[model samples]
Target: MWRWILERLDEQFPAFDVDRWWGIDDPFERMIGSVLVQNTTWSNAAKALAGLRERSWLTPQALGSLSADDLIPAIRSAGFQQAKSRTILRLVHWLMQHGGVGGIIERQATTEQLRSELLSLKGIGEETADTILAYSFNRPTISGDAYARRLYQRVSGESLRYKQIRHAILDEIKTWADLARLHGLIVEHGKVICRKRSPRCEGCQLRPRCLFFDHAKRLS
Candidate 1:
């Protein structure tokens, strides 16, 4: 299935490229950005993250000293400023209490354990946990978002629960690189061609292998 889809994508979009999404190199930056990106565009999240960084409050240690209200303006661009600010400050306190963000990552906890711990935090969810696990720690977790869900439904003709879908996708892909590349590709694809309301499958790279496209063609 993996090879089939990859071949189809390559054939249809010869110049198709998945951008490397590791913009914030530090694990702490990635972790904070991952949480801040919830229900927001990357541009907004980037702006907020940059705001925090500019004030040198991007670190857990710095955030530990700051109150939630004090952090609101820096992350206001990401929306839900107060709620997210509270969440971020709480996370900072937790990290500081545990020795710091570096201490948390340095634990090298198993993926499951780490995800559980993250979810235990106030605002962190499965998507945020998986994002931190995969992007921050280079763990092999299929980060299932709208992009991945839509791509899966289009290509496989299946409605899947989040965990089930992510697990299934991981099973099909060969390596961590494949998972990472596919995640980025589908995200870009979702933003560009494979929209929710009306996907542009006519000239899309995955149309050749997409179940929806094939079904439509057969009906016609």
Candidate 2:
């Protein structure tokens, strides 16, 4: 079901290129944006990121030199300024110590190891960790965010937990590119069609396969 859904989505929806979508092509900047985006909308996070970019603080070395307090002003738009500042500080320091993502790749580290490392930090939760892993490191895993949960539940007739959904998708994904595409497509689907309330089941191309649509049909 997941694989078919991915193929159909790829054919129907515009491809989600993270670098193009975020407009932050630098891997390090992408990682920092991940932190800024926590508990905030992407536009607010983009504002924080743009502020940092204007200050040329997106690099690990540049950001690592500053204290968490210094980041609050630039990232104030993204709520939880204090916590996010500290989290970004810790992440930068940790990344620098590990010799950057390139170095970590040279070490042939597994995705699980990197995920565990990220989760150990102050503000890095499962979703954030998996996001960094998938988007930044190009790992074959998806963030089990609300969009994913709702979309999957509606389609599969199964309500899985965050970690459960992630692992289940990983099992079906053979490569990072496919995983990224699947996640990107899922986000689009959730936002435009299979929304949390009043989903446009009639317009959704996947209506035939979606359990929620089937149920809705019975009720109607």
Candidate 3:
């Protein structure tokens, strides 16, 4: 099922690049964009990231030096500016105290260990932590977003927790590249086909295997 979905997405978005999805190259920038993307669209988050980059404030030292008030304007487009600014500030402080971005990247800790540490921080939830683990650290982990969650639930006819879904995907797909590509594909599929409202189900490639579509057809 996962492979089928990925293949369909590949056909749909031939030029998809997981790294380009967030418009960030550096691991730290990716982590920051992950946080900024919470409860917001990627375009808005990208704007905020661009703002930070333009000011040369995308670094740990620059973010750590600024107060939340000073940071709010740059990230206002991402929504919940005050809260996100606080989260970013806290993350920067934590990173600085722990030996900056390089220190964390160079640490000999396992992915699980790093994930645990990230989860212990203020605004870092399971999804965000998993994203950092996957994109930032190049770990073989699923960063299950809302798009993936909804798509999986409809496809499997099971409503599982985020961690449960992540574990299930990891069990089936273990390579970092596959996991990353699957994440990007799932997100793109959600946006393009299995949308939340008025989903384009009639000609969707996955309609044959989609539990929701099958059930709807049966009911009709």
Q: Which candidate, 2 or 3, would have the higher TM-score against the true structure?
A: 2
RMSD of each: 2.6, 1.4, 1.9
What is the C-alpha local distance difference test score of each model? 0.77, 0.84, 0.86
**lDDT, residue 52, candidate 1:** 93
Local distance difference test, candidate 3: 0.86
Task: Give the TM-score of each candidate.
Answer: 0.86, 0.95, 0.90
Query: Which regions in candidate 3 have their CA more than 4 angstroms from the true location?
Result: none
Off by over 4 Å in 1: 6-19, 97-102
- lDDT per residue as tens, model 2, 101-181: 787667677888888889999899998888788788887778888988898888899999998888788778769888877
Q: Rank candidates, lDDT, best first.
A: 3, 2, 1
Best by lDDT: 3
Number of clashing pairs per prediction, in order: 0, 0, 0
Clashes by residue pair, model 1? none
